[model samples]
Target: MGMEIPDPISIESVGTWSDEVDVVVIGAGMAGVSAALEARASGASVLVLDSGGRLTCTSAMAGGHFYLGGGTEVQQATGWDDSPEAMADYLGLMSPECDPAKISAYAEDGVEHFRWLESLGFEFNRSFYPEKAVVQPGVEGLSFTGNEKCLDVAEVVKPTPRGHKVPVPGDTGGAGLVVGLALDKLDALGVEVRWETGATAMVVDGDQVVGVTWKNYDHTGAIRARSVIVAAGGFVLNRAMLEEHAPDLLAVESNGMALGNTHDDGLGIRMGQSVGGVADYLDKVFVTGPFYPPGEALRGIVVNKLGKRFVNEDSYHSRTSAFVFEQPDREGYLILDSATMVQPSYRFQPLVDGWDTIEEMEQGLGIPAGALAETMAAYDEAAARGEDPEFHKAPEYLVPLDQGPWGAYDLTPGKCFYAGFSCGGLRVTVDGQLLRADGSVVRGVYAAGACASNIAVDGKGYASGIQLGEASYFGRRAGRRATAEVAQR
Candidate 1:
């Protein structure tokens, strides 16, 4: 007999409430924080709520790479010419299917957004070249270089590097940095932050959004807000949502040190849908590489179902996504030999020896031993020849894996409880208005960060710090806009 599946729990039974506020921001992630900060700056009373107990969401769990243009101190030093047009061109080329108008807005506003972030006390370091050869050297190199460079190269645009990282080293630590800064600002601005509050649904009166109904973790009563900003984040955690929304990619398995808050389960999206807010980009899901098993503190590699390597092995984000979306069966392996095991590359060093040996690693990571050995051999040959045979990985640097006591970390598709792909979500106009499917703007709604698309200038998944930059940029804009709307009222 088949196992019985329980019905989806309706949030209404858990809580109920009535309250009013100028702006109710959902999700304490980067986007939510930015939105709240922006709204408060605009002279509005704000209520910021999160489903999780903590303030930071997945955004905080990230590598802290912010993709921006024209303000990074590095761009000025490197003599890399860039502009909003160039940024837009890069985004268009990378994700051609992305809405052009929205992309243009992201690029155009990116300048102002970056500058705004600086004003908000968020410091962005100048561009530094990436250590890995296969990975593009600089953030600017990834988007606005070569034939990929913007068409108006001779315009003397004076492009600033956009990749700004929060000085923190790891995911949780990084989130602490961003969230702490934003929270400090929030407190000063008099924004009301309610922890342990989970938004169950949006409260709609007639055709417009009146507020939101949220509950505490204890399954207690609900709270209400007059105006709400659904920045709760993407549904990467809700396995049912993943299976229902993105079936082709089975599940998302990731490192435990995710940058964003894990509780972000697309409650905002659901609330938006419930209120007839048009949701776009449902099919466009972010995909990341497989890593070592959860709770293990080490970086690892990702191999396909056939136990073969794909993508540049060095890139943590790319490797994670490729392992999740591109591999067969949404399953893969992380190959590590004794040499690599002993002195793993800086990227994988933290993940070394976190799990068992190669064969046991294979069993735990879900791959065959023989196939894993063959894949390692291929990598070995490529390293010897000074090139990546399988993926044509750039030959700038090589790390061999000849030593024994080998290990293979298995990864099967699962919910992205920690980190995964960076794609899809809310649809926003270039001017930052949240849009509906018929190209209509949802009044009083705005979006930024991973929740909104068109700003990923390089389309290389989420850059290290770009989301925070977006949050800062649009958060300011949306805040000012919301404040203005309230003032008019």
Candidate 2:
């Protein structure tokens, strides 16, 4: 008699054979959700799983800005002229080492992805500018084609105001909106969702990936699939992974809360590695510096080990802040005052997670007793005389740090609580195919979002929500491609 195929596995098959599907998505963040929705839309059965108790991950905690050009409906109505070439040029300038071809593909198809999202009940504010427009200031330059002034037709890009923010209040609005919309769509499309399900490994049959072995809060099991999409996010929270992947960023306190839930620990990347998937962008990880504790906010200046300011603080906002962790001494401090911290003039808050009193904060951050006073006196003296004696910070951005019992946080050049460390990840083609170590495509596997290598376009983390945009774009592309492949087979 022929070998038995075994009865169809049930959903409760923990540590045993489980039911199968057309596709198994390893994350539920923007990329995973997008992949599931697209795969289902393309008529393939999909099972999207996440280790987080909740459905959303750091993606829900993002600023929610999607980069697009070619005069979106809102841009066109507002008379803002933007094109694919212009957007690509801006990305090239931001990341000169990036593959122009991939960046160009992102720019060219980003509009369509935005429109696709709109079709899925996702609403955009259409702010009439790019989110990280500051990457491309007022200047006419050549396009990726080396044609001088070819992108002159595009409008000026600002650091802010290029992308739309989620109308919902608070930081999570964007992530909530996108993930909510995608989840609703997936539900309507009948896609299966298994939350609190941690993927432990990929089950490969020869050269083909057959499925994934996952451990849920209840038990462990496996879900077979024709293809797998690894959207499990980057390794910002895995201290060991951070040390291994980016040792320079181990000291900074990561803005993990800023990204929402902290389950984005590169589980998918690790699992992919187990199944012969080669991880890329390990050396291209980004680093961030520490923000001034309560009283500095965006007005504070970050000084290096020698007590000197190093970068255009205003320009490098969130992305390059990781670099502070790479300092030789990995020690630096932010100089600011109580007035600035209390009021706040920029996007970042002076006191992260709220500690009210300097004493309380000092207790947690371990600042020397008198150091706060000395730093304050120095900053106050400079601010009172219309100068930054220590760091030469711009007068407008300078706020005196002379309030009672000033606060200081002993910060190293490691990942900050407000910033993550994984910047570059697995490299992928514009079409979302995971690449091999030799820069070739890995069949039956794809990557999207921060988990994939992104330094090609966003070398410095230009804005808050651009990465999510790329995630959504590539996630959808991967979903569609996987669906097509399954259908053909």
Best by TM-score: 2
CA RMSD of each candidate after superposition: 7.8, 9.1
Candidate 2: tens digits of C-alpha lDDT, residues 1-489: 111112322324435567789988988888899989889888888998888855558777665556655556656665566777776776666667667777787788866876887787856654332222222222111011111111221223321123544455443455667787888888888887888887776676655666777887778778888888989888766666766666544544443332334775666676566555566666555443324222235465555545545543444444435445445565555544455543332323233333555445444444455444455567667777767644445455556655643433334432234444466667777666777677766667778877887533333535444677678887888899888878877
- List TM-scores for all candidates, in order: 0.69, 0.72
**Alpha-carbon runs more than 4 Å astray in model 2:** 1-17, 126-161, 253-262, 283-309, 326-328, 331-418, 455-461
Specify the highest-lDDT model's number. 2
In terms of lDDT, model 2 sits at 0.60
Collision count of model 1: 42
- Alpha carbon lDDT of each predicted model: 0.55, 0.60
Question: How do the residues 254-286 of candidate 1 rate in per-residue lDDT, one tens digit apiece?
Answer: 333322346656556666665545556655554
Q: How much RMSD separates candidate 1 from the native structure?
A: 7.8
